[model samples]
Structures are given as structure tokens and as C-alpha cells.
Target: MTNVLQVIPARQGRAVRLQAGQAIRIVNTHGTQVVDTWCFNAADMGEFMSMEHLHATLGSIFPVRGEPLFTNRRRPILILEEDTSPGRHDTVIAACDVHRYALLGCRDYHDNCTDNLHAALRQIGLRSDECPSPLNLWMNIPVAPDGRITWGEPLSKPGDAVVLRAVMDCVVAMSACPQDMIPINGADCRPVEAHYEVLT
Candidate 1:
């Protein structure tokens, strides 16, 4: 039996420590929800997962099973073990921040992925500045033939999940992506509950 470590709610964030050989399973409880994820070396905060490195290493935008998520230091941090969704996750988009909201014409304070990531990292004695761009799980932002990217609803179904195993001791942070302005979350902006499990 696997032990349940933490369960993160929609629009919220969580940070957990995973040792090498351990895995964290992220479940899309309601489907169509995007999970923004970040990883960092536990011993050295400066070394964290890098999307640019991953793309250069894999030569593809999407992650495949059995591939390692490379960090800025050119080290493997996590390995993609399993994915049940439609494999539409993204790596190009940056987490939403206050400036983004302002550009969208939102005057009031809005809950965003960047802030959520910072909050989660704070629990581990880290700050927002240390947070890096994340692996957008279940997100669908497809590039057109003209090289324009289009945001669309996620292809993940209810109960869809992805399991990633840590290759080294690291801190894993996640945000349920509270992007309400787009169809990424069904255009309702209502966040759903996301289930997380750390398996030994």
C-alpha cells in the first residue's frame, strides 16, 4: 500500500520533499484542470528544473514516459513514470503573475499560480524568487502552423493523473492554476480539488 502524503485543493499550492526513488502522483479530480509544477534540488536551491534544458534534451515539447526532467545544473531531478491523460501538458507558458492579470484588465487582486507557488515554497523556508517556471500538467496550449500558440481546454478527463518519480532528493511545488480568464479551466475559473500521493 502507498502512503498518502498530501492532497492539494484547486487554486492552492503545496510543496513536498521527495527522496530519490520516491514518487508523487498528481490526480485531476475533476478533469480539465491544469497543475503547474516546479522542482528544485533539496541540497542546493539554485539548481532547479529547467524547461529549456528539457526541450533541448528531449527535442520535443511534450515529455515522454521514462524520460528525465533535467535541471539547470544538467542533472536529472524527476522521471516521468506514468501518465493517464491525453499527453497535452505544456512547458512553454510562464505561471500567471500580477502583471499578467493587469494586462488582462483585472484591477482587483486575483489569485494566480505565481503567488500560489511562492506560498507553497514558503513552507519549506524558500521564497518566491527561487521559484522557477513550471511544467504545466494537463494544460493545452497548442502551437499553430504559423507558430502562434492557441489556448484551449485541456484534454484530460476526470480522474486522469500523472506519476513522476524523483531522481534526486528535491522539493516539489504545485499550483492548481487559477487561470480564470481563459478556457484552460473550462472558462469557469472555479478551481477543483487535486489529489496528491507520495508513494514509496
Candidate 2:
């Protein structure tokens, strides 16, 4: 099957629909960018992908290839098909929002994952405040021996990617993380292009 590729600009958002049996590949084009991702059942938004359910089902904080991603309704939505980078994706961190920037001492408006998610969802005529926490791809948040979580730089190199097959028809939303205040995307907060491919 031919693949359809979409490039998500730095600090921007995108929305796409995937049918069951189709796969989406997210590429870390520049290596240091983090992609905040979320998925919803195409038939019902209430049964969206749940990070809590995934944690409970997998018993792990990070994603592993070949594992199924469960929704809030306990149904499989997508399966991790492949991972080319070090498997350090995070599922525990909440998407960045306007309030986070405020807490970080930034009184000005900043591009954030929450707003991006809303904008992406809006493209499909779905509007709600029930934005689910996302699976943070290529993001490095290491847990210390003392249970301390520290934000670190991503481990993926340029062109690294992860592929996931949709178990059910779903709408996927993604945001190139725009956090410049931390080392999550290396020294600077500059965003980079993220390449996405949908393969039938």
C-alpha cells in the first residue's frame, strides 16, 4: 500500500483519521523534538485512549513495541508496530497547557500542547474540554533511584520513528512540543518538523 506523509511544523498541530489495519509512523526528523500524541475512537470521543488504562494494563510507565494501547473503555485502539529509537517514550506526563507556562513564570501566551490538541480536534468539528493526556513520544523523562523524575533530552536521532497500527478506526492528534524552558528538546526551545506517514 502506498503511504501518505504529512509534515507537522514546529510547535504546530495536526489531525488525521486512521482506519483499522492502517498504520501511522511518526518520525523525529531533527532528533530532539517531542511529539505529544492522543487518539480518540472515531465513533465516540468518550472512549478515547487513556494513559491511566494503559499503565494499569501494561504495568509499565513507558511504551514497549508490540503492546496494545487501550482506551478508556478498556478496548484496544492501537498497537505499537515498531520503534527505531531508544524506547523512552513517556505516558505519565500531562500535556503542556497555558497554566504550565504561567507557573514557569511566563505571563505571556505560549504555544502549548493543550491548545494545539484543541485546535486539531476543531478541524474535525469535535469540540470539548475532555482533552486526554497524551503519549509523549521521543520525550526523555528519567526516573532516579530516589523516585525523582527529571526532564532530559530526547534519545532519538534524526529520522528515528515509531510506528503504530490502529486496532480500530480512530482520530489521531499530535503536537510538536514547544517547550523551550527545559532541556526536553535539547538546549533551546526551538521546535522542529515531525514527519507522519499513514500506510494502508
Candidate 3:
């Protein structure tokens, strides 16, 4: 049987898990940090983390109470189970990658979200390329009337967290925002930790 556990980032590490139907939650140990995320299925790869379908079903791009969290097939994967305000999260922002590095004028650093993503991969004993895109669950990006997404003011406070219950066993990867060049990370990315327990 699969069991739940608490994982820590320790400022430079990541918390990753291969939860098969077991629920898991990541807390923003510190407020205002973007949690770089990635996911994969222990079951399938083609039907992997699809954010487009998730946004379509969860209209205007935000999760709400009693709403079904989306899967690659646009079906419910995890329910919002608990949150301070479903409105406090953002599901549109894509995890930053090397290409983004060039776009963001960080060509000198050469590091990107993929670093954290790769870390997540290593934790689960997989390669970075084997991972799928992730949803910025509580990163708080807002859509302007012109269909533009702006980094909105953060809505999560210290100790505030998003809780999700897995409708199916799945693998997820997380980072404590190692970004340091974006508004989402205040250009000073640091670390965050997560704790999980099965909700029986």
C-alpha cells in the first residue's frame, strides 16, 4: 500500500513524490515564493499534464470551492478539498525553462525552471525530459481585460497552503521557487517546504 509523507526543501532542494491515488499537499512555507512544479503518471505518458484543458473547464483560469481539479483528459484529478480561497491561486503560468532564460535577458545565468524540474525528476528516479509541464497552482497570475496575464499581487500569506486530494495515484514534482529574475519570485527566489498525510 502507498503511504503519505512530509518532504522538505531545505532552501535548495525539492520535495517530489510518486503518489498513486494518495493525496498530497504543498504549503508555501514562506509567502510570495513561486513553487516550480511538474508531474507525470505512473500509468501513462501521452495523457500527461495538460494545462489548456484545465483552464477551459475551470473557467477564466482559477479553481473554486467544489470544483474538480483537472487532469490531462480534462477530467477531475484532484478536488480543491481545502483552500483559504480558490481565487487565491493561478493555473496559467508555465514553468520557466532555458528558452525562457534567453527571453528574460538572463542569458548570463543560463539556469532556469528546468533545473528544479530536473531535480524533481531525479527524486522520482526519472529524467527531466520525461516530465510534463506544470500548473502554478497558487502563483497568482491575473488576466487583464485584454486577455493579458499579469503577475498579480500575491494572495497567500505565510502558513497559507493549498490542499489537494488525489482522485488517482499520480507522481508530482515541486520546487521552492529557485527563480530570481521574475516578479513571481521577487527576483529573489528562495525555498519552501511541503507536508502531506492521507485523508482517510
Count of clashing residue pairs in every prediction: 0, 1, 3
lDDT score at residue 77, model 1, on the 0-100 scale: 97
| Model 1: lDDT to the true structure | 0.88
Worst 10 residues of 3 by lDDT: 10-19
Query: What does candidate 1's lDDT look like per residue over 1-200, in tens digits?
Result: 58764678778899989999999999988897899999988888889999999998889999988889999888899999999998889999999888898999999998888999989989878764555779999989989989899988889999998899999999899998888888988667567768898889
lDDT of 3: 0.59
Stretches of candidate 2 exceeding 4 Å from the true structure: none
Candidate with best lDDT: 2
Clashing residue pairs for model 2: 180-189
> After aligning candidate 3 to the native by TM-score, how far in Å is the CA of 67 from where it should be?
2.2
Clashes in model 3: which pairs?
20-169, 21-168, 21-169
Better candidate number, 1 or 3, judged by lDDT: 1
Q: Write the per-residue lDDT of candidate 3 for residues 1-200, one digit (tens) a residue.
A: 33455554532435344454565566665566656555555566444555677778766466676666676787666666677634466566666666777787764755455677676567767664544556665577777789887765456766566666666655666666545555665434443454443444
Question: Arrange candidates by lDDT, highest first: which order?
Answer: 2, 1, 3
Model 1: how far is 94 from its true place, Å? 0.3
